[model samples]
Target: MNTQDPLSIGIVGLGNIGRYHAEQLTSLMGSFDIELSGGMDIAPTARDRFESSFGVPTYEDHEKLYETVDSVIITTPNRYHEEYAVSALESDINVLIEKPIAHTIESADRVATAAAASDGVCMIGFHNRFASPVQVLKQYQQQARFGDVHHIEAKYIRRRGVPGRGTWFTEEAASGGGALIDIGAHAIDLALYILDFPQVTEVSGVTRSIFGGRPDYTHLEMWGRSGEGPFNVDDSASAFIRCADGSTISLDVAWAANRPPNNEFVVQGNDAGARLDLSDGDLTIFESSSAGAPHFSDSEVRTRDDDPHRIEQQRFIQASRASEAPTVNTVEQALTVQRVMDATYRSNERGRAVKIDSEPLPTVD
Candidate 1:
């Protein structure tokens, strides 16, 4: 890794995640072997803040920022991800678009198309795929420790937590669905990836905005906004998913709920079961058998909280230099997650099991 090779990095969108990446770039200046060429944000105040904090060049125009950098990270809102990603890729700059590539499948397709048309690199930020616990689970599952996974149950419930009250997050069009699209998307991606991305057969679910207009719902404020703003999105969602191999996944997500637990998931198979609790930082496995007394067991390895985002960024850099495909590259792979999301929304609308397009979209070169 040569520091003088001008591996210039540009950051689009100066939100929390964007700022985190910017700080990472600043911290990795010595060892990571890269340059923070510049950064862009639509808000001038944000740009000013970024420049003041990091002493990096700031551009109000993203295009100008793109012209000066070799690679760009799109951390904008969901609606604008495709716009900035496509723009950067068209400029022959490698790009790493944040999760939920776009609000719509069509936009995700366009971003992939632009990347394929050019020789530039493009990858979606599915960071959890890089976490150590997740990687370990994947390895064990690959070794068939669970003896053929038959079912998975996941719950990402929070005790009264909802993001920026009146901001773009609560808006349906800008951020897509509320709870399901936000936290549920991560859970969905994790489960699907672990399941070897089983072919989704059918999806049925319901979504509700239990306290969208309730002023009393003030105990948990995710975005740190006041209650006067409209919260016209689903606060909770539940879905029943059927895989092509006859396996099932019971998924539930709630940004705000009066539950005793925070966030947890259980992956079960004939031979064993494992519990993953993000808040507690634990991934415990339970070995069992139908012939003996039901029991629990734990692997002797310690779980280290690996910084998934940093690992994801490093992988992008490696892939860019090596001209290799990332673990989760292709728009079609992303669409697999999107299909479940779309079906969930449709099922909520129709109150019935909706069929999914099992056939993946054409792969991009």
Candidate 2:
């Protein structure tokens, strides 16, 4: 496909995130020479809603949707990621799959293998990496500003933020694990990206289902339908990860907890340290003076107002048009993060640290 031609993009799964992507793509059409080739959702109501809101065609079948567009954005539930992504890749259609790649390492590997064999571009949606502050940190890391990194600490906690308490999110079979696979995936990806995705040597972790199935659990807001259903997933998880380079990472994620909400990523290096507040996208750098005098410097790096989701989509479009892979949000990177997450769950189950033997996958470029 010529880069100059208007790229046609379709969305599969017209759920919350899918709708958001559709809106963003629509907004982007004003600037980019592209076409919103409608969307697909299994639910009839969702399809009707999407078609009514966007005045674009909506299909009940993914194959039909795939036949209409050059690229596909998969916003389906975790369980369906592999199926949709593999199908799209097999059809020579570019794909941008929402994060975690798939619910399990096996499924993620299938998607990765498909991407490796396909000529079309494939990217995982780790939109947090597109944040201005994260971009700056990436720049700093590239320049070796944080020489000899020692460790990274990432937290994506919530006082009460469980989604669909009785829905697919609370079901292990549908959403994989709980907090670790959901928001925790973002934290892990961000930390790994900052650390240049060092191979994880070992992982020790624990998960809890404290709040799920609790009738008294309270939150500022609730997502999806709330009712009596199986809530078998973890509500909180913590993990200690050791990398091949001797650097360590401490990760904590929770959908509901008793503590105050905190969302941040801190990278600690021998020479300098940096912190990114995931809540506001603000980055703070800490450094000591090289002079004899004992002095410290703390600087806050302001972030851009750019919507990360939009930035992510724009890049996906650009890469797809060029038939090139994304440098940051590649399938390999997602696979690495997935491996760490899988290791975390395994460690929790084994009640000890689990050894990670999977080597990093090569990048498409």
Q: Each model's C-alpha lDDT?
A: 0.79, 0.89
Clashing pairs in model 2, backbone N/Cα/C closer than 3 A = none
Clashing pairs for model 1 are 164-223
Candidate 2 structure quality by residue, lDDT tens digits, 1-365: 56667999999989899999999999999888899988998899999999989888999889999888899999998999999999999998999999889999999989888898898889999999988899999899888888988899999999988988877788889889788999999999999999898888899999988987787877779777775668998899999999988999999999988899999988899889999897977889999995888899998898667899999999998898888887869888898899899998998899999998866574464
lDDT against true structure, model 2: 0.89
Cα lDDT tens digits, model 1, 1-365, are 23357578889988777889888777766766677877899899889888888788988889889768888888887889888988887877788888787877677778777877766778888777787877778888899998888888878887777787667677877787688888888888788877888889899999999865476766633654554446778888899999999888899998887777557768898877787776666788888554577555666445777787877888877766655556564455677777788889899999899998755565556
**Which window of 10 residues has the lowest lDDT sum in candidate 1?**
220-229
Q: TM-score, each model?
A: 0.92, 0.97
Q: Count clashes in each candidate, considering only residues at least 3 apart in sequence or on different chains.
A: 1, 0
**Candidate 1: count of backbone clashes, pairs at least 3 residues apart or interchain:** 1
Best by TM-score: 2
Q: Which number leads on lDDT?
A: 2
All models, RMSD in angstroms: 2.5, 1.5
